[model samples]
Target: MSQVVFELQGKADAIKTESTLSAFIKNYPVLNGYTKRDFNLAPYWKIPTRKKEKISFETINITDSLKNGASFDDVLTSLEKGINRPFKNRKEHVAFCLITKGEKSYLAMTFDHLVFDARNAETFLDIFQEDFKGKKYDGSLNLKEPAHLSMWMEKFKAGQRVNRAFLKMADKIPPRVLPLSSGRKGFKFKILTFSKKESEAIAENAFSQAGYLMLMPYALSASVSAMHEIFAGRGDSGNYVIPVSIDTRKKEEVRRQFFFSNTSFFIFKVEAGLAARFPELLNSVKEQMYSQVKADLPGDICRASLLMRIAPPSILGSLLKIYLKGQIASFSFSYVGETAYESPYFMDNKIINMFHMPRVPVPPGIGIFFQKSKENLNVILSHLDGMLTDEESKKILSLLKSRLGVE
Candidate 1:
């Protein structure tokens, strides 16, 4: 249980290999198409400071720990202990616990909410491991410049008609829906495993029938639907919003090195009847998802930054919050899907669980986290301890199985 600390003089080759950010962007289209200019959603440069300190430990070598059934816990503890100025940095950055199990060495990297979102995390891990073999870093620091917020603003200024339409749509949304909570909460982890065969089928059904090549959103929808059934049958208050994290990095943006991530709320407006007609419910879910994306598209956000006209960081943050709350849809799930998970080494401990902080006032929220192994999918839910009893959580999980038909 003792901790060892050391200074890591990263080899140029290793650093290059470790720099898997480019690979991450390539894997997830959701992340690839952004320029640094689109970072208005989540401004990394505007932050008061850049925290680049690293913490390293070498104790109970990873291989030994895994043999003793203490592998994951050791890595988790290190991550929980890592610290920085933001206070939440420990929970916001990815940590790698490299293990050398003879001929099979792997690294485990757990991403914090601050940078890598759920979907991007998985992509990062794969690229990370692939690059860790000491290959030359294929990425160029000379990436394209990010889209300037000012440019986007000019476009919007010339088009007030679009603004009016957006405002009109905003008026239709219900007020007092939900707000992100600023409360301190602990996360619980659950590991759900599926064999390769089962996972392939699930992916096939999701892509072929549902038209979603990625499993994260599909799984998220099913998870939300599950929670909905749980609350509805019990007659407990049933309002929920799904928070989806959006990456503001543009494809041609050089500042992709910077973190400018933002989260968008997706409302799951679940009704008891929708559950009865699963396909119709799914279509409604899909349509609503598209509309939410269209409503607050990244280009539009860049325009928003330009309209504000060189506003102070603090002011911009306030305006962003108001805009997010007003424009984001209502629902019970939060998604953070665009960030990287490059580990320092291969044979790293694979992350098996994740729980997103839920919006305040509401009793339940869900987040999806998957990893490089792809052998596990973690569905994290947070609710009033008393409101969502054990039985209720189990029931919700059961519903998820029936709906997704995952074996």
Candidate 2:
């Protein structure tokens, strides 16, 4: 199984909402299996497979745990503790925790990255809401055949020239590392949310000026460029790469697939000598991103998965560790679109706020996740603890906000 990359939290009215959610879980058996299945990864680095198992919703009452009234932070801390507890080996890959503090209750779900990527998680929430509303789940996920031995071999052979070109390019430019404080131990999480008007303004401006359907990559490119300029000073120049995760579910072949395990990364390179203005930088980002998409980089990357079966597990693990520590500067993931719970109210409780924090690997030590719900945009900045102090995090976020024209 892949690593547990993030945690998701939301609020709902205590008793009725809890009952409804529990019922929803029961009604949608897929959710149960998705949460309960155990991954088998041994013998070799073959594609991980899951075995279904029985798992029930885990509920906790913290009314007595909190001395008087607990603040949101207190509740969050407790929820994190509960959900982050290590799962039993060879057991479930997903877990749910319901925490109650006084009259308010919180729902926290933890997922193994292999089991649920951002798109799958959001789709799960949609199904949960549908089940809660008394709708039947048709279970119409049309998953394509898994990329097995033959498929991977075919793609690998076809992409040999492209892969060789990418290797040559990789050798010339070193991976760009963010200017974060060193000696960080753990991780720090922060969420920056924009008002409906601010989010709308950013979207409208991008569409009106560039005719771009998605504004995230442009905004991200502009922000990263602005931050690099500030940190690198006036005269320094270099090439930098930002690895952006792209969801593949939108592809017709994988449409509505319930399978959650997949890795699709697009590497966008920004050169200091070119595209300084926001608009120019945006065009550059779009061109590079679209170019990679046209090349079917995601499928090509998936083809590389076959190497897991061929290479020695020990060697593969070591190489991956080195890559994570040295070859990646930062990660940017965005889920910018409508979400299931857009009404601000769910199950009779005002859905206060919802956000996700992706795991931040050190050396690079920073991750930016964006989610748009209703008309609001929620941005989460996660960094290795000592890598970025609170003030520094705020500053980076401020730069991003200014770049997005949110301020």
Candidate 3:
């Protein structure tokens, strides 16, 4: 809930893109987010009018003239700088950095995850582009909530449901996890973008193999299988506990719930042996998914989260650490399904591609994300630095590519 990223790659005039981006962010919903230490349950934001100079645009020209901009170890080094750089203060929460090489440009936005989730990031882009094209961004930026201070009994019951679910998980052997490397902790990304045909094949395979409307289960199955191979190779064996985050916002809710994070998790426990069999694994994943849906587990999670908001963040953090016993999950997973920023253009630039770089905390320190844009599936593997060996990383990615039924 600290910083999250959204990256845009496309053709645009470097100088023009910078100026346009600066203007776009100036008017975004988040200017400078502040959380006063007054112990308030409901977070308050300082969405003040913007200052052109207070917000800075960092341009890393890979063309080799800029210094901190110039002598970067590589693109990833510069990118990590852009992503992990702490906000100047509570008065600042978002940072935009542009990386240019000859005619290509990559625009990155790092914003406070407390205020924006992955979906919020995409909607941010779409809104900005709409504004750039003279069609004002007409999003329902409704920031009002009931404070959720009432309904004690309901909240208690919701908590009980969530607790029971996790407790059940606790009854099993701890999931296999990759031990944290004591190495310096920056993140590295391996991104694979499938072509239109490959994306089509994945959807078709999802239907044929997992069943109708089961793309997510199919994708999750592939991810579990990918990680299982590495663990199997290492002779590590145990059930895999993966918490899959799903967007809680429905189709109609996107317009109203467009500001904050709207996501919840479906915890899946797959036995190691089951992951080796794709068909059986897909069935198991789907079974867990459907049963959870039938039980409205995600809904209970969303309601339970509101109750959690009353606790001070520090206490909440402590309780989380204690409850999980320092092992959160086998890894993190999510499927954003479709692109929110599906437009073909941004400002006057052609919108070539869009993807998200979401971090997984150190306990897990690994996440597999899937997003579809322009009929292509973008698979993003985000993990902490030094967590996976070079060969292991390549093999995991290869396994994902092969597992997804892509070439």
Candidate 4:
């Protein structure tokens, strides 16, 4: 199962936070539900309206912060461990780890990607905060959705369109992708945070280079340019394929759509020969996104995805593997846009900073994510343990930073 994690750093009161979380879960029974499907039947969540209130919350004490006599950063080490810890079972789709380092506190919420997408995870937090503060909020009873068994022709047509898109991709150059090594698999990451001033400067450069209000294209172009070096050096002139994950929920849907994943992928590919040209890549991405959005490709894909509710997760993975020809993409890419949790304080503690650490799935065990908080932008470089060394990761990010006009 894939996982998405959020690391919020600040001071914390564990007892208070735990109580608030417990109350929050009681208000939303879907937290303890599990997805199950009978043979050939549509999957439905087995949510218990009367079950024990149990949550996976662990408090780790860093008695020995050092391993093998090497120094370790408290926050990162804790978060690395927190994100690595999977949910105990499918029914438990979320887990919390609170790490205390003297006065500094780090809270890591590791969520099952099947349970919540990236954007809604922030909304989940925001609502939790509202609950903790004793503020009234909308009821969550409207979150339950239908099996959506109707509209057969619409689904088949949507599937046809999505399949045609994939066929179109395969007709082009074979996607350039690295072989996923078998041994141990885990992610190594690099977080690049731009200061407010630097972020503004990059916004200016984005408008000048990509276009007005085109920050997503600008950031993506920079990352593509950064990764093009590695791809080019590998001596393969294949098309660079990137799947952009995006949220499809409206602002008003937050109250009713917080239970499951509400996201879609935008398939963006550029030929290796043109990947290095900033202007060309930017234009290609913009044009591709425009055409897809205009054609409602993302919406169609989401509608088609309902057909998978009958298949088990294992089968779904197998199908995806066959579709990708043993390679998923050049790499995964996404821009989460601005975070929705704009509160200055969380659980009465001033938030120092926030960043997402998603465990990008294995076939494509690498991802570059961008999100904005306040006026600053945070970029993350995540890849499997052996996919890139520490030096290589920093260098790739450095290249990205330089391309973004940041020192």
Best by lDDT: 4
Candidate 4 Cα misplacement greater than 4 A, ranges: 1-10, 38-40, 61-73, 171-173, 183-185, 248-250, 312-324
What are the runs in model 3 whose C-alpha is more than 4 Å off? 1-11, 37-42, 46-52, 64-77, 183-185, 248-252, 314-325
Ranked candidates, highest TM-score first = 4, 3, 2, 1
TM-score of structure candidate 2: 0.74
What is the per-residue lDDT of model 2 for residues 246-329, given as tens digits with 9 covering 90 to 100? 553443323256446544777676765553566677778888778878877766666665656544546644553354444545
Cα TM-score per model: 0.56, 0.74, 0.89, 0.90
lDDT (tens digit, per residue) of candidate 4 on 18-77: 777876877666777887765559787888778547677877655543554223355566
**What is residue 35's positional error in candidate 1, in angstroms?**
18
Q: Which pairs of residues have clashing backbones in candidate 3?
A: 66-70
- Score each candidate by Cα lDDT: 0.42, 0.57, 0.73, 0.75
Better of 1 and 3 by lDDT: 3
Better of 1 and 2 by lDDT: 2
Our model 3 lands, by Cα RMSD against the true structure, at 3.6
Better of 1 and 3 by TM-score: 3
- Lowest lDDT sum, 10 consecutive residues, model 2, at 1-10
Best by TM-score: 4
TM-score of 3: 0.89
Task: Kindly indicate the candidate among 3 and 4 with the higher TM-score.
Answer: 4
